[model samples]
Target: MDTITHTLFGLTLYGTVDKKEMDKNHKRAYLVTAVGASLIPDIDVISRLWDTAGQYQMWHRGITHSIFVTPLWAALLFLICAVLFKTKDKRLFFLGWLAVVIHDTSDLFNAWGTGYLEPFSNDRITFGTIPIIDLVFWTIMGIAFVLSKKNKKKSPYYFKMAWILMSLHLIIQSIQGFLIYNQYDGKYDQVALSADFVPWTYSVIVKQDDTVTIFQDNLFQEEKERYVLVSDKGADLDYLFSRRPEAKTLYEWSPFVVVVDDGKRLGLYDPRFYREGQSFLYEYIER
Candidate 1:
């Protein structure tokens, strides 16, 4: 449920549904709307970051991402679009809402989990399946988006294939998560390194050294003792910028700090949890 994937769902959903108006400007607008909607679910960040983190804990992606808030967000977007563009295209409005709904669906498999049924409960929900981002999955969709942008004629097919592939991959991840839950009864951390565990870009890795056991975000499965946070591995940014080249600007402000250099990829440590002993968790990557 990082920003990127949600935006991709929004942009592709809008693009596929409104094929006739696929001009350069229209495509750009789609990208903008997708990015906006992706961020909409995170508006609670402001309160969480500025006033108090618990404020976000209370609401965060809770309400905005729920079934109830989905419609409200769609209606709000519809009204704004009506005022700004002066058009009442119900198809477009519905398409926009569909994007929102689909965004939540995608989040169901994300590693950090989401609250689709918030207020009713504060518990985060996830199948504990797919890593937030899968390289092959993202690369395929990214390539398709690139091809579509270059050759307008093939854009529809490319976009459709990309979405389909992403959806299928997510589905597999969900099923796997459910199976793991049944087997482990929530005893296991739910995320392991390989397919024997779950092959994904994001998952909760349980690290146990002696007696200290804690949850570690496993985006890159390195050594048994080494793990990286999904965000540190570029989970959120990768999703948002996957389609829109312009939105790269939004990720310019990285929440983590660069700690070391391996000559190939730079090592990063999340400022939130960087401290003595824990400093060894720094992960490296180029760019």
Candidate 2:
């Protein structure tokens, strides 16, 4: 999910809690815990400043987003609350844990996956069932916010209902993606999916040997061929990697890539992100 969505998740979670009985200081601590835990996993972005080996691709959304690290983040936040607010509530730790866990787990649903297992595994787990910015989630949260304002006494209930609706949206999208993915099974050697901003729509990338095909798919409409890319199997990547280290990182980071090797240039890009004549994720080095 994007940063803004994560922030909304934190605020929604806070709204779900009934804090009417808590003192002002305790309420502040809870709010801090929710927002801080939600934003902490993205702290891995700072790794760019010290990344010298062109490993920023692997570093961002890496160990910091790991489930194993969630508890540690919660513990740190708990300590911060204790020191700053002089509040010793054990429930604060659990609330922080929930927020951090949700942050890491929700990222697994998108095309750009996370290193949820981290030290135990380097695999980038992704369902590719949800878009990076899901408008359905925004709609649910927006409605909940409005309803909460209209009925302050039932604010917690309204937010809880919002969470349920968001979960249902994910379930529906995942099922649709699964059905679309199955249509190409056994037809290609490898397949990858990238969900579109609109629900029930997906960009499907299928690779068979040197050829890669991109298709726009939707549950209600016939699939459309978007682009077909060919990879030069004999392209020497040593020179390209030496000239542009980020190219190597991009290759490693992507599930699969369409390699281009004309005599004039060498480049690679993920077919799943191909759009408007080029992919934003493309990395190349000129010959």
Candidate 3:
């Protein structure tokens, strides 16, 4: 999920709690606990400043988003909030834990997935079920925000309802993606999915040998062919890897990549993100 969605999740978590009798300081502590935990996993972004190995792509959503790290983050937040607000309310810890878990889990649904298992397994777990910036989530939460304004006394229930609807949306989207992926799995050497901004739509990339085909797809309809890419099969990549280490990382990170060798440059690009005449994920070195 994007920053805005994560922040909204935090606010929803905070609103789910009944703060009616609490003083301002404790309320502020709970607010911080919810929002802070919601975004803490993204702190791994700082590794970019010292990314000498050209591993930023892999490191960005790496171990910091791990389930193993969630409890530790919650414990630290608990200590900080307790001292800062002078309140021993244990609810802060639970809220922080839930928020952290939500943040970590949500990223798994996007094409640019996270290393949720991290130290245990470095696999990039992606279902490609939901768009990174899902308008459905924004709309659902927006409705709850509006309804809560109309019924102030029942605001908590409204936000909780938003959570329920959001979970249902995830379930529906994942099931659709799962079926689409399986439909293509047997027909291709490798398959990858990138969810469309519009719900229930996807860009499905299927690779068979050096040929890569991208289709604008939906579960209920036939896939429309968008682009066909051919990879430079059996190309020597040692020189390219030495010239651009990031190229090596991209090759390893993607489920399948199109190797480009047109007698001028050596490169690798993930076909999943191909658009127009180029790909945003292409990494190359000029001869």
Candidate 4:
């Protein structure tokens, strides 16, 4: 999910808590923690881009996307916030950790998936449920935020109701995704599916064809050249690579690999490249 959804979630949770506890400072702290925690899942992109350039880099939502980082990140941030704000509310600490957990919960809907335990295990987990971005959800939250801001009445009731609605929508979409997956037949059938959480869209590449279809709200969008999808049904990374292509210079990685072909020049291609005067056969190697 994008920051806005997390922001709204943070705001709503904090607003509701404040209404009950009558602690404005704690509420503000909660809101801040919520928004900050939401971004924790994406820290992998930073680590990958800056720390490890290429060579099977972990990006976006990986180990950092797991439940393990929740407490650590929340505790670290909570300590910083506590020092800065100088408050002593146990409730605030709980709120911070809850917000971080909620942030990871938001990503479970998408197809791109996340590795809840990367450092522990490289296995990727995905329900193939929702798209990262659902316009309907965005609009609902946008309207709710705007209305809540415009209105002078600071009622937690409305915020709570909005949160319930959003959560319900996702739950319903997840049921639909399960149905779609069960109905899936032969290879490439019912491959793409989307599950979303506002601005963030998670696309599942169940089976890759000439085009990778990402289902969202019952529609498919072909990934032209984003990622190379591979089946992880069985076999190790090396075994999967062996089955794909027989290129000498080809590189192998889990779910995907870099295949160097003897083209007019050295280039990248994984059933998605479209260029002038390119041969699929003369293609030198596959991973």
Q: After superposition, which runs of candidate 4 have C-alpha atoms over 4 Å from their true positions?
A: 19-24, 53-59, 185-192, 195-287
lDDT of each residue in 1-287, candidate 2, tens digit only: 99999999999998998988999989999999998998899999998898888888888899999999999999999999999999999998998999999899999989888999999999889889998899999999999999999999999999999999998998999999999999997899999999999889999999999999999998999999988888888887787888888889988989898888888879888777788888888888777
lDDT for model 1, please. 0.52
- Model 3, residue 265: C-alpha shift (Å): 3.3
Prediction-by-prediction clash tally: 4, 0, 0, 18
Per-model TM-score versus the true fold: 0.63, 0.96, 0.96, 0.67
Ranking 1 against 4 by lDDT, winner? 4
Error of 4 at 198 (Å): 12
* lDDT agreement with native, every candidate: 0.52, 0.91, 0.91, 0.55
Clashing pairs in 3: none
RMSD of each: 11.5, 1.2, 1.3, 7.5
TM-score, ranked from best to worst? 2, 3, 4, 1
How does residue 147 of candidate 3 score in lDDT?
91
Sequence-dependent TM-score of model 3: 0.96
- lDDT per residue for candidate 4 within 1-287, as digits (tens), equals 66666666676666555355446666566667666665655666555445433422334566677788788887876887788767666666677788778878777665445667767875556565655556666666666667767773755556666778888877877776676555443565435454434333333444443333333333243333334433223324344334434322123222332233333333333221212433132223232
lDDT of 1 by residue, 1-287 (tens): 56666666666665564457555544444544554554577666666456421233345556777866877767766666666665565554565566677776666655345678877876666554655555656676678878888987777788788878877876765665555334333554323321222354222243222122223333343324333433223334443344432233212322223343334544444232333445432343454
How well is each residue in 85-191 modelled by candidate 3, as lDDT tens digits?
88788989999999999999999998887899989999999888898899999999999889988998999999999999999999998889998888899988989
lDDT of 3 at 204: 93
